[model samples]
Target: MRTRGTGDACATYNQFSLGADYAVSKRTDFYLVAAYQHASGDQRDTNADGTNGGLGEATASIGSYGNQSNTNSQVIVALGIRHRF
Candidate 1:
């Protein structure tokens, strides 16, 4: 199957995130977060020829990500620290 653009693809994705922060001495805070994403249906990914088509087409992902995921699922884990004066 082929699609003219992402609008034609029935691709779908879902994301889940959980995060929390702890204050340390009132000067800074430490944070940790975990996120996961999954894609389903016909994803219109960038094609080799650089066309807006299905798996072998399109130039961008159906979501905010840069490129369409080659796999149906994705996961991300992050940690950070912040301080304000």
Candidate 2:
């Protein structure tokens, strides 16, 4: 599971995972998996040369759509192996 942004960075919504599979005979098998995730936030930018431009230019002079920030993070990894008859 993973999530981000929502009241004080939503506690960073971190995550981790792991898996494994093994078989040496009758066909052959060896599998492994792993996963990780991270999140962070606190850089809301209304766009003013601060980057993270999702909606900028002074809210388009009035339309209002200038506010985009990003600093969240994420990571994941996995290994695999299979054999079938």
Candidate 3:
């Protein structure tokens, strides 16, 4: 969880994540991962001088994907397999 901005123009984010892995053999494995994030409140824009400028809505980005959703919530899921030679 994290927070940014100040007063009524503050943005708060809550995030949760889960992961699991299973070994199928000595050199093979399967894995699954999921993440979710939710944002609340407002986020104000900052001027070059670091002063509050305009008002903006909060958004959610799952983990470090760098893809912020248009809304206030986001979810991501991934499944994969690994093999060794």
Candidate 4:
């Protein structure tokens, strides 16, 4: 996290994340991840987690899918397959 100004000013707040993964087979897997973030002052017109800073509040973020939460918290899920060639 970074400060909102050049001085020691806290523009961001508390945050947390949780994730889990499971393997259905030797080459198959699934994953689930979720996170939460809070803001107080200003997030440069955005949330601390890449979400829209609606009314300058808290928000959340998704995975690398370029998606984010519409509210202060969000969840992300992924299912994939892997092979050892």
- Who wins the lDDT comparison? 3
Ranked candidates, highest TM-score first: 3, 1, 4, 2
Clashes of each: 5, 0, 0, 0
Superposition error at 51 for model 1 (Å) = 3.7
Question: Which ranges of candidate 1 are over 4 A from the true structure?
Answer: 1-7, 48-50, 55-69
Tens-digit lDDT track of model 2 for 1-85: 6544554323334556677888877787888765554544342344567555442111101012232213344344456667787
The lDDT of each candidate is 0.60, 0.46, 0.85, 0.52
lDDT of 4 by residue, 1-85 (tens): 3223322333444455676778877866777765555444433455678875444443444435576555655555544555544
Per-residue lDDT of 33 in model 2: 65
lDDT of predicted model 1: 0.60
Q: Which ten residues in a row have the lowest lDDT in candidate 1?
A: 54-63
- In model 1, residue pairs whose N, Cα or C atoms come closer than 3 Å (at least 3 residues apart or on different chains), thus clashing, are 45-57, 47-56, 52-58, 53-57, 53-58
Task: Encode model 1's per-residue lDDT on 5-66: one tens digit a residue.
Answer: 25556655566778899999688999998766665666555567997654532122333545
* Model 3 CA lDDT for position 22: 100
Task: Encode model 3's per-residue lDDT on 1-85: one tens digit a residue.
Answer: 5655578778888888899999999999999999888898888766999888888888886777888799999999999999999
Identify the candidate with maximal TM-score: 3
Model 2 — which ten-residue stretch has the worst lDDT?
Answer: 55-64
